[model samples]
Target chain A: MMIPTPSALAYVPFVSVANMMRLVHSLGPEHFLSELAAYIEEDFRRWPDFDKTPRIASHSRDGVIELMPTADAESYGFKYVNGHPKNTRTGHQTVTAFGVLSSVATGYPLLLSEMTLLTALRTAATSALVGRYLAPEGARVMALIGNGAQCEFQALAFRALCGIGTLRLYDIDPGATAKAARNLRAQGFDVTECRDAIQAVEGAQIITTCTADKQYATILTDNMVGAGVHINAIGGDCPGKTELHRDILLRADIFVEYPEQTRIEGEIQQLDPDHPVTELWQVMRGTVEGRRNARQITLFDSVGFATEDFSALRYVADQVRGTDFHEPLDLMADPDDPRDLFGMLMRARDA
Target chain B: MMIPTPSALAYVPFVSVANMMRLVHSLGPEHFLSELAAYIEEDFRRWPDFDKTPRIASHSRDGVIELMPTADAESYGFKYVNGHPKNTRTGHQTVTAFGVLSSVATGYPLLLSEMTLLTALRTAATSALVGRYLAPEGARVMALIGNGAQCEFQALAFRALCGIGTLRLYDIDPGATAKAARNLRAQGFDVTECRDAIQAVEGAQIITTCTADKQYATILTDNMVGAGVHINAIGGDCPGKTELHRDILLRADIFVEYPEQTRIEGEIQQLDPDHPVTELWQVMRGTVEGRRNARQITLFDSVGFATEDFSALRYVADQVRGTDFHEPLDLMADPDDPRDLFGMLMRARDA
Candidate 1:
């Protein structure tokens, strides 16, 4: 049997929200987490081969819009994302994203996906992957602070990747914590609802702060954090937005994905410009140590990088290879004669 | 009776190639050209309000992919474009583009349109808009060098905006020149196909050079370009790619859209870094002189800019409003509760 080639040159594959969810379920959420982690790790292992740049941001009075672009030798990917905390008040997603993965040779898009869900998945996968290296050996309990859209995914990823069994969830809004707890309960997780951040962190070996605040508000204070616990800080991803207290950052050994970007947008932005931080890629590459002593506080200050999104796109492109979950979108114009674009447009009138 | 509000917040309008062609024909090509020229001129008149930056380009071995993003206080727009000279052999456009216009207040995309056709239209509009200021009085004949996809658009734009009725066309490939002549003649232009580049410039008041080559090429030598001709050079838009002879640039008083970008990407790259050049926006804004004397050579270095795409997207968005030419696209994930994105996915699974 002759294998058919993908018509990517003429039609770009698009994975909508419904299709993305179906794809994730088809892979089984836990298996998908591990597979995505592997792709991310594979890219991280050869980190220097890809083009890395801080995301381009357009700031507004209420929120910010950003375009994150990166490319390897074979593929180019970019994500368009918006962060509007006030959007929730108007019944709109606070953070909605879409991405395109394209051929480097042809400069044509191959896969376009709704990245809002994928971003949450990859972020959790990355955090859990880091936890695999940096967390205490055989860690079981995780304190998930600021329970919102990302709370349940982080819980499942940690359970699947880091061997965590219990999730202690807390949010300022009791309704958010209740929603996450209900979701985790359905997924067979040992869920604990806490009254406050301090209560959530008790008896937890891993602590994750994924709040959606646009200010420098601390969800984790220095006193609440103890030694030997891994801190996954995902909320402090833009200028003037930080989750951990400055004192907590001073106490921890910081590891980051792209320190140049992390220093500007991560929790490290609160510290000195010259504050030493090891790149997570180096640790994943095994050139640098992840966890040293029993009492060492290893903090992953992840201001999400483009490579992670690229990996997520790679995952989606792979999962939907021969499936019906994706549809082709005629996003680019192709003509019989490249120089005859006007002729093509003119002929469209007859067609 | 209750009035219905536009469902803009729920759906983004998408203008496909068929729809864009229909839109162009609906307004009649010449009238559409004049209206697009007016929009381009309006944005140029208020150029200071725009957030201008050189396009972010990802250069490959064969070509380049670029993202041009810009924003005003109320609206944001961006274009994804690519240039692959060798793509024509594979039946693909050398230049393919798409763009999005969004609300700055909500960070929601309002319109997504294929920019391949709009780009051609706006490039012609901008060229003609500039020719109106720089071209000599009673200019009726234009020398169109390097006739390619942009050839006919340039021809008609000059006719609509600058009162040019005759076109002298020449290309290295006679087939391309023939194609352009055939297209222009059908549009009622007095088209004359010239034997060589030197022959094409004879008795022409305005000259447009729009070849697609990734090299330092001289389609117009210093000796070929006479005084008092407004040269619209649109081909040399990347690093190490220039169309005019360096000596031609020495004699011409060059005008550009953005000096910071034009110095790096336009024909002026061959000149001194601090070489004095006038901003075309300033000329349109009445802050600088356009044509000082009849004998002075004026060259408009037209490397495409972000604001022109902004204007094109703006025009398409306006023209397609309440019309069937554009269909609503569910490009964004608009959940009922922004914080409950995961819940939305779960609900979709059930539905």
Candidate 2:
């Protein structure tokens, strides 16, 4: 039996790590982050129409593997990601990811992309987008307490979306701080390598803590967080991993991507189950006000929701069209007749 | 500052559709199914050691997309699959899948493979493995109902595992039955293309029903099922999709992969929520008997489980070692300094 060749539907567009870097460079990271933030902002504006769920996590002693899945009525997306702090000692990344976007009608993948860098871009874009709404008007100096893999991206995103031109960087490891300072300075920012967290937050309108320890870390204590400053907490993402002291959370008016998820994995996990929090989508939709007063102390408790990843994947799928940035992978089994998969395999022996 | 080439750790082995077909041809289908069944049976024997959850599904108007995730202490695995029956009308497979297996300690993906063929192989192997315990002794004739893409694989597996040399096929669409008959006959089975379900099960000792309709379907009723016959119900996998009539399920001493999942998606979904069903693992462990008497009807309500996909990926990982059946994918970002991701991206401009 001679089976016909597989069709175009068998191919899926795959963006590799190398291709992702090239694409990011082709568009410029600043422009890429800005466009990605636009996509995220657009998705958040229609948040009520989405299918949302807390990420499914498989926790191990050394790390955690999580599947974050979400969909609109038309398209579905899911990301496979892992977080392991000890990986850095072994010359591996603390976090890595890949994601898939598919057609909801036919259930076929349209794009698969390396999401390690994309995750960083989305998190930064999300943080900077939140900064635009909650930070004091015309605020330019921002304190970044965790100068790790995510620091420079956040710096660029803040510069692009929120017009922040000055950055203060700090890390428990001096090497991490020095690296971030060097990268930010080269990117045309007034960068300072701070001595500590207190110095990092000094004279800054925004205090962003992104430390990556898998523990309840006091990266920022109550006294260190000044009044009227917008706090972006990015590192306390998983369970038992909180960045700020509980007192700071009690003082600030918090906004979250998804309340149900932010409560478990975000810094809000430190608070009571029924603690009041605002949804950023509502604020974006203009149904609720942001930064009610200059000294309101707005906090964006960013846990990195699945919809952000969904929006990121959607942005990449759109950008990679008619570009050499993606390789088409023969991932699906397409038979001449849909019921002749076995015959197709048999014929492939000779093809 | 040119970035160094990515480390070997950044590459993951990817088994594509063409390469999977080549691999299956190299090891012959029968041998592949037998080995896959063995791996599944081995994993089933140690059922208590692994984590389990019902597959998480995203249902849309047209079809459904699902993520099935599970892990043991050493490895984690998940499969992304979609079911869209209407896809076949447009020259697309009704079901397609891909899966990943990762290291639990590092949360790094070890293998990414096309599971469309593997899922077919695994599902057929699982049914035949169950058939070994449930099918009547020394039975050589089997009735096959709803002859679709899964029909031939089930026939081959039953012949390999249960010594069933005769095949009786019937389908609502005659073209499907003709295709299955031609394929099975070429594989050296004594084949009969029956006019209807009644004629198909006339003299067979085992009845395998696999239809891909997305609604409640009665391929067989209580009157159609004879005494001492083994019933392998395969198509009633999702909610609202079933094959055997409720009366047949009521009479059969049912065996299930996971009771929680089987109650929701398997043929048992039509029965009481708390209906007693035997765990297949217990039967494999010799803790529970499969078939007690010669005249009792035994039913294997297989909805397919995450552990089965986990075992299939594990088997492929072991088999593909030192082989050319897979390609390396640059899917992860591995920088020299784990915290210097931005530096790596900057250096990539000159690489």
Candidate 3:
């Protein structure tokens, strides 16, 4: 019997989020979310194969801009993102992002996509993935503080991935809470709009603080966070942007994406530099126990890492293949004679 | 009397080299070269106003890639470039680059252009600018070593800026020499193809070395160099990639764009860490001397820096405005509601 060899044509075509969304809608959001969750989990399992670094950030007066770059042996990926807390006052999203994926062997960019939408989706996916292991079993109610642009995505991801069915939302800006409630209602979610953080946390199994203040304002106090609650803190992402009170952090068993990055940018930045925190990967790898007791409070202090973007880029690329949503960009030159760079220009001029 | 306000449209549109060449060809190359040289000189005089740093580079097995970023309070610029010495053997360009200029206040990308061609132009322009200050008055001939992709541009810029009337050229690859000779002859230059490096430098007032090897290969030795020669060392741009011998550096008064960078990536890499060198800005500022005596050999260790790209970007953006050569690029989203990034996506989806 003759065996057939795998052809070079086995490569998946790249998919932009616009294209991926259409495919996702066609596949139904529930199925797509499940597949994305699986992809994230699988990637976390092979985390050691990646070349990782705490992102290179350039800070400005108003906010901070950062480039998070990572690569494995086969592919390279990076995201350009910014955070300006005061931006929302001017009716602008506090966070905006874009990313590029390239082939490591050739160093040629294969896909360039507007990552603003994908970032929201991936952050939610990662939180949900962590929640699967760290959250209390059959957790159904989440207290969501700071119901801004990312609130609906977080609620939907939890509802779909962790069987969370109801949301208790609170925001300083009542308009933002209303907007989040409207968006979640459109997505078939049941939300209770609360007047205060304490009321929002009442009978909640998960407390998610996604506020956008640049300063260390406590959106969550220790008295508000109850036992067996998974605190998904997302807003306190920079050096001075803490949302949860110090007492709450001291009380909860914390897990982070990357310890070095979390120590600087995550909620743990409020704690001592030498404070013990478990890496989320260790929990996923079964090296550390997560939510070991029924009443133990668990915290996923996710400030977002490059590895999550890498996984998102990989999934988006795989999903976009054979779709009409992307254009082949002339980002790299594949000249017949590479040394004759001038010759290529001369030809372009002549043509 | 009522004073009329100036039109509030002072934005500069960016043009890539391909488009700039079209605009230049229409305006004439002589005018473009002279104007660009003037702009470079003017920017050099105000160098203290700019923020400068040595590029952040990522090294790989085949070659190295780098991100050179710089900014003033008004504008920010960065270039992504890669140098793979073995790339040409596999039908790829040894150097490939692209750059972007953005508004510092808004953090919006204003221009995106291919820099593979512009790099050659800017590098040549920089060399000629340095030669104008360091070379002996009315120098007429330049010995062009390593007649490759960049040789013609150097020759043209020198001819245009420094009153260089003749060229003496030599390269290990005879075909490259022939190509350079043919191209220069078309441009009405007096070209002499010499047998070796020594013969090429025998009667020249300036010697320009631009060979592309990724090792410490001495293309120009101290014995081959003579007194009063202004050497434009252009090719040795990474660690372990020096062209001129150590003794040559010892004999010459080395000037560099950024000393911190040149110490590691330029020909000065061969010298001691404590070796004395002058920054070119200081020379332009008259704080340091360029050439004290006619017999003093001066070297412009031109590894290339980010500030040069900033100058070039500003120059190109200014020249392309009010012309048909550039198309307005929508690289950044200026939503009426900046906080509603998701709203922008919804708009795009609806469109």
Candidate 4:
């Protein structure tokens, strides 16, 4: 049988960094986060349908590169990401990412997208989605420690998803705190710049830490976190990198995206291997309890997972359906006769 | 410290299928094959330096999609490939591939290229390279039992690398044999088209079987393969797919790329679990002998490996150094302040 020659079918829709930013702006940040949260929650509620595996990582002296793959019955997705904390010193992003979505039936890629911006949006959405379930009632204030790339996204996602109206920001670098405070003030949020993590947590109902370090520095001490507070920990996402003290994990009701991954790369990595932690999917599925009482501390030990990236990909693929925000990438080779690949190359010579 | 904004450095060089074919033609097929053979040999001699892993595959009812990743001290490479045996019936390729080469230190992709043509080239280069050592001295004639997409390339590679002057082509379909014969005839090789497998191996010092089927079908039987003939078996690449009869395997001294991989997906799968087989790398390194006698039957059980793909990517990255065969793909996000990713997004509003 003769196969069809090259056409648009051979091209995958690719969302570049410029297009991603344009799409995010076109959708508006708050609305985009809310919609992303909805997609994430829907996928989490059906988490059992996914083909899940811990990320395959290639580590180096300065950083780590990872491939996170997941698939369901209909579609497959994977993310290529890197974490190089020292990259910031060289004027490079500490974290950069891209992803692909493919059709499981035909083994063809459907979408390729820049996930650096999407990852920030989705991580914030996931925190906000889980916060709606675990955060205390009438939670209107958040403590955002380590004011870096992910700080402002967290503040806005919490505002859009959980009705959070104020942000208490802190960073080891005062310049970073000032930058975050300035950005949030423009977004119409009541912003507080704190001198230390202790001051950032004072009188705040939710605390989010997202520092950029490949070490085990405790951003939060056991004494800093009070009862009835929810901790959204995002920075401690690789081995030997953690933000919370082990004693803090003991006093909190821990929630994670995937326990197998969190045990190796999340804040819980500092704890015992068999430490009891509830999966956020179980909490979303209503099969397990999230927050026990008003006096209990809740922790969402957020090490990223493949499914969330898959959700973000699916979201972008869905949103860009009728838009020109994507370019077709001529990535796959299509020959007229599938078995006549040589003939195809020969014909190209004549052309 | 403030980082530089996005620029061409964030763009990866992407070579499309058409560009790849143009490259092959510009370099001349025979010379390109010889150069590829050299690169493959150089990488094989230092096989211990590579970080190797068996491909990760996701299988569906009709096919399988796979990711093969490998890295050395300086560069990392991976190929995204698919195998759908039934795709030819519906006007699609049974195998299509694309690959990326990245900087290990920076975690930045250096090149992205269509690997369909490259895979065909690399596979043929590997077989010819191995045949130079395993085939009997002064072997000029080769029996190409499956005259399909890969047949012409194999014939030319053998001509370039092993000085083979003649090709005897055969396939179940007469049209496929005609296509390969026509292609090879234009390349100035003395070509003979045969009716069946038995007639194909007549008076040939080398036998190459590369049929496209996903079953345990015997394309080569014991009596058809005589003594002193080196067989290059290519198409048996998955768990249940094999080409040669079990009896022929018993008589031939087998050489494989990787034992752990070949044991699961090569012609040697028919043998006992502990049956002895020499690694081709060892043979290339001169630690193990190949074709000890003129009367010995040597077989190269070829199930493509990750390092070979890495070599191909490295070769392409090297060849496209100062050429315009590739377009710069804006794939990475570079923010002015590495920690001010949200600010970057916010500034996009003014632009």
**The best candidate in terms of lDDT:** 2
Rank by lDDT, highest first. Answer: 2, 4, 1, 3
Q: What is the DockQ of each candidate?
A: 0.61, 0.86, 0.25, 0.68
Question: B2-102 in candidate 1: lDDT tens per residue?
Answer: 12122345466878766888899889888999999899889989998998888888888888888899999989999888888787777777888888898
Per-residue C-alpha lDDT of model 3 across residues B178-272, encoded as one tens digit per residue: 88888788778999999999899988999999999889998888889888989999999999898998998999998989889999999988889
Candidate 1: stretches off by over 4 Å? A1-9, B1-10
Better of 2 and 4 by TM-score: 2
lDDT of 2 at A20: 97
Q: Report the C-alpha displacement of residue A131, candidate 4, in angstroms.
A: 1.7
Which scores better on TM-score, 3 or 4? 4
Candidate 3's DockQ is 0.25
lDDT: worst 10-residue window of model 2 chain A: A1-10
**First chain of model 4: TM-score?**
0.97
A332, model 2: CA deviation in Å? 0.5
lDDT per residue (tens digit) for residues B1-351 in model 4: 333346775688999888898899999888888999899999999999988877877777778888888888888888888888788787777788888888888788899899988999999999999999999999999999887778888988999999999988899989989988887898899999998888889999999999878899999999998889999999888888999999999999999998988998899888898999999889899999989999999999998998999999999889988999999887888777778889888888767
Top candidate when judged by TM-score against the true structure: 2
Report the C-alpha displacement of residue A148, candidate 3, in angstroms.
Answer: 2.3
Task: By DockQ, rank the candidates, best first.
Answer: 2, 4, 1, 3
RMSD in angstroms between candidate 4 and the native structure over all alpha carbons: 2.4
Candidate 3 CAPRI grade? acceptable
lDDT of 1 by residue, A222-265 (tens): 99999899999989999989999999989899999998889889
